[model samples]
Target: MNETHRSSTDSSEASHTEDGLSGSFEANEDVEKALLPHMDIKSGPQNIGKETSWLKLCSRWPFLVTFLNISLFIASFTLWLWPAPLRHPFKTQDYWKETSFYSPILERFDIPKISRVTNGTLYDTNPPSVLRQRIGKEADKEWHRIGDHVWPLVIGEADVKQLGKDPRVAVKIPEDLGYGSDAYIAQTEVFHHLHCLDMLRREVSYEHCHQQDISQCLIMTMVTQSTPPTPQTDLKTVVEARTREWHFHIYFLLQSPTETAAALALRDAVLRLRRDGAFVAVPLFRVNEFPIGPHPAGSYEIWVPDSSFSDVFFYLAANRGNLSVLVHPLTSSQRRDHETRNAWMGTPWPIYLDSLPSDGDVPLQYPELGLGWSTSPEQEISLEERLRRGAKVEALLANDPEAAPAPED
Candidate 1:
């Protein structure tokens, strides 16, 4: 009877346990059904917890959400508005614009430097020669120093005094010009000629008429002693001569102020023209203080090539101020070149034709630094006596102190 009681009690406990498990499962289903509408399709237990925490934080500090949104908006707008150039802040435009280059071995003590930023445009405004120097290419050496070589077109005695000790130019103050040394201070042909005429007028007045009656004397002289009409020469057939080279002898009186000034001015003009590359071949300008060979009076020589003959000839014709220019050709016969094969600009002066050699080969001699003539004017040989003379010239020039060095590439 005790064993039957125990078995019934066990059966009752087992039925109760089954009923409790079934009830708990039903309660869990009800809870899930209630929460189904609030949960997202992708939500998991961890994700739902995170979303709930985020919502709680936003509710507690409303300004935090606004600040975050505004910060995001500003950052996006700034990124959009940023220039394209600044997008790649660390990138270089070219190899020349290396922003971070260091060479400890090459420049151990040098301060770190960054190349300038360029936008593929030419911003260099320096002169070509200066620019060349900056890039390590040597600038060209001028034929002569312009400042030291050239004289002014016209300058006063006071101004001349200011320019101390320049030997290339010849300066003089006209003496006994009656109008006192200070009164007449012109260094041009026009003014000098006027001064000469005035002196002659004074002399004529002293000899013939009183100083008060000089004006009437001059008028009478002009009317009575009028020059005869010039005889017109017939236009002859122009023949192109067999010429090698040409010389433009700019004749000036050494002591005369006007002629010397004009000559100096001409020299300056020629040098400037050459500097501008106006001549085909650079002409040599040499001042002859003493009369040499066939050239009378103080003269300067412009040794020009056949190619540059016409340009130089026309230039002298237009610009030879109150002075004489003997444009002569170089031919086989030296005497004929001076006397016969010559043209004159302004008043023709008498050449010492007897002094010139009658028959001889006249080889052209260009200036030592003359362009377009010789690759090496020193080593260059003339057609005649080149073996002895040319070698000596080359040696002399090579050893000369003033010779320009070859330009660097």
Candidate 2:
């Protein structure tokens, strides 16, 4: 009976121990849950404080931030608006800059002050047929008459013994001498010499025949150095030393209103030839933009390589029928290139030789020989003038039904 009572007492003490352990575990879990909320609240306020600080700093230095933004905007705007040419302005002005070094020399010689009255009359108003007929008949007679008097002057046989003898005989100086600056003093000397020759020629001619007015007649000769002298080289040596790649400039001469269709067809044919690797077609120039020498009034130029010269020449010769073609060689001397070596397919036209530039350095390769192709100033037709000319041509064609064939016919 005593052993059973002891067992019941031990069982009751074990149950009380288990209940105490369960209650302690529940209190520990509640404390951990309550601390998690405090940790989350503390982290949230810290993040908010960081963001507020940055906003406060910006608010405090508003003017500084605004100034920085404006400075950046101006820098970007300036970079965008700057001109490409102004960035390297010296490159474009290099030619002028080099020429400026000779300004002192030009001023010392009074080069720019010298001038001459050039023959600036245009006698090309007549149609080609009438002009050709007139040229054929009268050209030889006039050439012969001028040749007699001019030959002596050209050969340096003119009598200058009576040069300073006459007080009334004064050497008239031109005020504007183009290309005269190259050989300023030499040109002046030649002018004086020619004036003396003219006086003598007049006297001798009048003695033979008193029919023509000899008083108003004068022979003007302009002498200039073709190229500037090298430091240790003579003219003959320089001329021989010059080497150039030969190029043939073949020009197809055309006229406005009359040969417009033919010109266009020729241009198309030239372009087709270019595509076939035969020759390169050059752009057609306006009347005013034509080269200074005896080039066709309206024409399209084509560049034929030395290799294709024979082929191009033969083709053009056979196909050019009645169309004027001026084929000239490109040489080291611009003057010589145009004046000396040239072949004419049709009627040769008279060129104003005096109109070309007299003082430029000859190029090693052929240059585009046209107005505005060089630095020299030249007269150019404005857009308005070109438009007006086009309108007039259209008006004339419209009035004359026979000028061109109708589209259907």
Candidate 3:
């Protein structure tokens, strides 16, 4: 009897549970039907089932939906329209006391000591045999006398006659003096200067003959003995506007073989101008394989007289190939001569301006070189003839100096 009672109780509970679910589903359908009139006709009946719950929520609380939409738009717009914040300047904050910071790795490192070695003796004290053989006994004995090299002996007949007629004099030399005919005179200071250089060269042994030592000796001798000219104490001071001389510096790269060869060729061409007794006024120039004075590159100087300035300038401008040329004046003010009164061919180069003097007399003069250069336009060699002779000299210079025939004076 008790078992039958338990089975009957179970069947009754199942029937009640099914009835409750049906009632709940019918209530939801009734709610959806009531909300359908509020929904838009454009939604159509087919979408009613899908949008039923959403439509009921919006109808009950319209302001909540509007507020949520506005909040979402503001968040999105803020993110889109807001400008990017700028980076702040970094400030070192005292995280700990400055004394607390320590770099153990850096403390262990030690700076390496640099050792410098300098060469003291550049040249030998003993004279070379080749240089000894070239020196004359009298010159060797008088090597201490700087004047011996300052003035060389002029024994040539033509040089003496030419010295008398030199244009440097205020008055003409008397024709009756018979300088060339009766007595042979010594050469001018120019030749003497060359002689002195040769004497200095002989002091070093051939094996010990360093170009730097020779150069340094000459520089030291000149610098120690030389003094600037005293300016005249006059009431009226006169400064000449025109330049008396000019320096044409032909530049080349010492490291480049081709450029060096071109430089040598150009030098040879200029030297050729002196051949065949032409362009005698063009003085002997110096070729510097390294930087000297204000020049910053390997260069050679061509000293141009005021009279032959145009001809020489034209020639250099035409001939300087892939090479830079610095044309500057020689004047009382070295700075002004190089800075203001200068021109360039090809590209310009930087020079050591501080090496030049601010105020001084012309550094070099023809009077010091030799007697004087004749400036008579008629006597001056024509540019065409110089060019022709230069070509021939270049050809001759290309061959061995010993093998080549001597160039005519």
Candidate 4:
């Protein structure tokens, strides 16, 4: 009985030992699985959570990790030695921004440039034929333009007020000279220079670095403001009554039904005279304040500085296409001394004026005056002669309606 009991005890002890060994082996297997890199097992409570599949390592030891990485790098280099085909550098906004300095970069392109004359200076680009024709229609003979580019430039004379500060016509502005109070001469000089700008530059296109369309506006405005009275039967008779023969004087010819309007009309007409390259400038002229006799209501006497009279007369005769002109002989001073009483001339004499026309339209002149010049001087053609020439030309053309045609290939 004792022997059987001892055998049972030994069997039970062996079974307990076997069970303990089996449990320890299973626990070791589970631990090994957890430590392997990138294995499908959760690494709870780590900075890189179980979702971090992008980071895969074969070893748990720090040194082992270093060794593994070195091997991996070598393998990568070997793969690169026989590299795959290239791929696009970027696939998203974040990637694209990293590669490029933001698309749509700004850069300036060089282009040819040009300018248009206005107020005696060029401020805009010349237009291709397209723009030039359009602007010309509006300005008549008043503007000239040039181009560095395809743009059209606005051209007009600069005004006195704009001279000093404007990019154009500043040289003519007056500065204080020691001549002191009698600087009226200086004022006169300034006016003369500016008035000379009253004409367009002799048909050329110029250049300006930049542009402003002020001159065109100013010229148009000034024309409305300047005026003198008009209307008389004969411009020659009016001047003859004012001064003796061989004297210097200017004659204005017009027969205005309305005196006030005639004055305004004359003013506008004169301003636009330079629209045609003729009559470059109107010379210094003064209206007669005192008269020799009872002049008609619309008559005016314009005095020329004695010295300038020849210049005035010549300019008129050269440019006169119409009007009956008579010269009275009177010797006068071109310049006056600056004394009030002792001076023989109050001013370089003066042009006389008695009235203005009634109708206030300009560019609208009396057709009786032969040439359409708002200003003067056109080849000595008298009014009657001018009319006669027009009639003759019409008759000749009417007689031969079929004109000659040159041969063309």
Best by TM-score: 3
Error of 3 at 95 (Å): 50
lDDT of 2 at 283: 32
TM-score of 3: 0.32
Q: Score every model by TM-score.
A: 0.31, 0.29, 0.32, 0.15
Q: How close to the true structure is residue 390 of candidate 4, measured as C-alpha lDDT? A: 56
At residue 1, candidate 3 shows an lDDT of: 39
User: What is the C-alpha RMSD, rounded to one decimal, of candidate 3?
Assistant: 30.4
Evaluated at residue 399, the lDDT of candidate 3 is 75
**Per-residue error (Å), model 3, residue 254:** 0.6
Q: Which of candidates 1 and 2 is the stronger one according to lDDT?
A: 1
lDDT, model 1, position 140: 17
Compared with the true structure, all predictions reach lDDT values of 0.55, 0.46, 0.58, 0.35
Point out the worst 10-residue segment of candidate 4 by lDDT: 334-343
RMSD values for the candidates in order, in angstroms, are: 32.8, 24.3, 30.4, 37.3
User: How many backbone clashes can be found in candidate 3?
Assistant: 5
